[model samples]
Target: MKILNFHIRGKMAHFRRYYSNSSALSYSVPPRTTLIGLIAGLLGFERDSYYGDFDPEGCRVAVGVCSPQKKLVQTLNLLMIKSSNDLNGSRQHHSQTPTELIIPANIRTGFLDYEVWICHQNNDLINTLHTRLEQKYGYLTQGVSAALGTAQHLGWAESARIVEGEEVAEAQADFFSILPVSNVISLHLSESRHRLRLQKEDMPIHFHPDRTIAGKGNFLINASAAPVNAKVKTAVRLSDERFITWMED
Candidate 1:
């Protein structure tokens, strides 16, 4: 049998290559961080679990991860018109990193018993996304095997939290700008809304979207169409498509 050699970062690099012309992402932690442990815990291997030791030396394996759909922008405390120049000044800005993941109420999960909130200041997308999957997607992924790069496929969500009043330095000058905008809808690994799974027999539970007042035509996003990176932008575009599909369904 042929063993598959999968590099977590390398796979993301492929995605980046494909979407580079649209949107690019900067990860706080590489996708490989949880892959090794996932393989060990899932295979029940006590020691080194090399591909050749179990499967084959050269096989084709697919890898994936649950990522956030947002971008980092410099914070400038200015009116919308005043901030127009801030957008133009981003030609030489550093890459933005993902800050957190957003999980909706248990309505997405069949149980509808508990409201789970997992916070991460670091690379928490993995954990948060995992929780959403287990609760909302009928636990499609399991054990340590369900990790970045080791899993059969990857997933993502678009809902996010906004960090306003954050300070970002530009040209050695301090400016307060809300770097990323959090979208109302998030992506989950389910074809149907998890809320629909609740049987009529189950106890009554009230689940609704968190209310927010915003002007029309305003959606959350991290980056714009100015830069040319398809991969980076694909995630957002995919999220939009998913939203449209969900609404239509």
Candidate 2:
């Protein structure tokens, strides 16, 4: 998948890491953050596009998060399972209920070197996930607002473009947002799919060892999101030493 420079914008957030314009900026999250998906009944997002990373059983996917908080991560996993059940609880009248949360690893890294699983298959589940996130966490886009579109998500758009499997194409309605909290920050992206087609040559430009797991044929919409909800001023002035300390912990 080709990576395109992208951005997103919300009430008071924008992703600056990969954004190039004012209207588009979202959160800047570390790579491999856990992304959760609820298996709802209606069609959510396309499979190739939303699926982050799959497991041996093909029942779970990996998503990178900003930190390694066990309690925080487990809560999200459990919530996804419950939401998924609410969406597709009675499919074909299956009995053995699916495990609500699947912890792939006991100790995981925050973004920049970690991944979480998301079981997204339909829009209803996506909606449920969004609502749950918003409620549990006061805000989901803080880093973007604090960063003003110039942080970790520096090359996300370019990466996303490649995912479209196209080259030298034009897209409209691309936006970015940021969500920063304490020593952590997350980036969010939202844009129009119609304008993000790629050419053959552009596909080869986006190949990173860390990003290869997604592989080809996996075309996820450029809605890169994270859970950064740090306070404002403190987030913008995060010192390198402080940032490092946060990650190490």
Candidate 3:
């Protein structure tokens, strides 16, 4: 399999959970939909135009947390717009909303890092995407900028390149990326360097042009930014000897 690999580094990130009602809570890591949106933004894809193309049938994506992270809830002053005329806050109406933000665990000398791997069936599209990222990482120019959920927390792509990998039929192996529940047989949580906190989230799988989410799936992730030693059904072994489970898997 041919995959484009890169790391997104930022000072802060906030991926709002799908079911967050009043307060803006965030996911520990960016979900698959968020990953697709990031790639689309870099490629300058129009709003809601490329979701289908990045779906499971057209392309595959896998993301792994490369750094330890933590969440903080802050009260944000937001405009209380009652109508279109209130958009400018002319009425001096405002609301305090609790917003959750994610940052590096060791904020003193670390940044939020997410390793992204994407493989597309269309050769031309994949090649173009890789070129765009390569220019971004190499020349620090070309392509649009990347942001973590909010535009204020801007991010950049680094170490972007193409990689070659082959599918492995290993029944049980350690995986460095988030694993879809359907792809896992079981996890060996007993053997670990520290306490493990496994959490599952119901994330949107795909979005439609009509502004409605089409599919959703549950995924498991390690909150401590550590690889999960688990039994897996299938995976891709990259040339760097790293194993990853696809988001669609």
Q: Which candidate is the best by TM-score?
A: 3
Q: Output the TM-score of candidate 1.
A: 0.20
Name the weakest run of 10 consecutive residues (lDDT summed) in model 2: 240-249
- How far residue 102's Cα lies from its native spot in candidate 3, in Å, is 0.8
lDDT of 3 by residue, 37-94 (tens): 8777667788788887887888888888888888889998888777899877786757
**Candidate 2: where are CA atoms >4 Å away?**
1-28, 36-121, 136-169, 172-249
Clashes of 1: 24
Model 2: per-residue Cα lDDT over 126-209, one tens digit each: 344344333333323323221212232221110111111221211121212121122222222232332221111101112132
lDDT of each structure? 0.23, 0.24, 0.82
Q: Score candidate 1 by lDDT.
A: 0.23
Candidate 1 vs candidate 3: which has greater lDDT? 3
By TM-score, how accurate is candidate 3?
0.90
lDDT of 2: 0.24
- By lDDT, the better pick of 2 and 3 is 3
Question: What TM-score would each prediction reach against the true structure?
Answer: 0.20, 0.19, 0.90
Better of 1 and 2 by TM-score: 1
lDDT, candidate 1, 30-110, per-residue tens: 212123334434335443443232221111111222222222333223222335665654444444432222221222331
**Candidate 3 Cα errors over 4 Å, as ranges:** 80-91, 136-144, 193-195
